[model samples]
Target: MLIREATEADWPVIWPFFHDITAAGETFTYPFDLGRDEARGWWLLPPPDRTVVAVDEAGTVLGTAKMNANHHGNGAHVASASYMVDPAHRHRGVGRALCEHTLQWAREQGYRAMQFNAVVETNLPAVALYRSLGFEVLGTLPEGFRHPRHGYVGLHIMHRAL
Candidate 1:
């Protein structure tokens, strides 16, 4: 698979799965009814922030990741990121590859560490992946996320030093 910076033209390809994922309300905290324009504004970040997509040999987008400083000014040294893998392409290492790529990018950009602010506790696959990649569960906010089927679930704050 090829992982590279995403271009504006890629948005159309990305939005379908992005909308599906967010609407599922299984992982991401984005509003279920989030509109295209608002989603675009959030995903297609500019400048010091970076976004990338992973594609197969046929050039089909398999997954995407966005990375940026977790906060500005005093907290700028730490980075944060989000990832989404096409449902049709799950369990094929696409998410892992996207994560590895994002980590490399973060290191290259001089980030001191990376933090995930609101990882859903029930998203076991992602939480496991992050732990395997050296992230630690810093803490969990009790019943922080309202999962569609699971009622209120904990939100994990995970961290890793770059």
Candidate 2:
């Protein structure tokens, strides 16, 4: 798979998968029916954010990620990121590669650590990946996310020193 920085034109291809994942309301805390323009503004090109896409040999987007600061001022040295893979492309190492690339990019940009503030506790695969990548479950906020089907689930705060 090829991993590269995303450009403006890539949003059209990225949006459908984004919409599908967010609509599922299984992992992210975003509103289930979040609008396209709002998603574009948040995930595509927001300031202090860098979006990237992973594609196969034929250029089919397998997944996407957005990396940015976890917070402001004193917390800006710690990077934060989000990932989404097309359901059809699951279990092919796309998410792993994207996470690795994001870590590398963050460190290259001088970030001291990487934090994921709200990882749904039900997303075992993602939790496992982060663990394998050396992230620790700093803590979990009880009933932090309201999953559509499994309401009142916990949210994990995961972090890894860069």
Which of the numbered candidates is closest to the native, going by highest lDDT?
1
What would the per-residue lDDT of candidate 1 be over residues 1-162, giving only the tens digit for each residue?
Answer: 999899999999999999999999999999999999899889988978999999999999999999999999999999999999999999999999999988898999999999999999999999999999999999999999999999999999999999
TM-score per model over all chains: 0.99, 0.96
106 in model 2: Cα distance from truth in Å?
1.0
RMSD, every candidate, angstroms: 0.6, 1.1
Across residues 23-119, which tens digit of lDDT does each residue of candidate 2 receive?
9889888888889888888888555579999999999999999999888898899999999999999999999999999999899999999999999
The C-alpha local distance difference test score for the whole of candidate 1 amounts to 0.95
lDDT of each: 0.95, 0.92
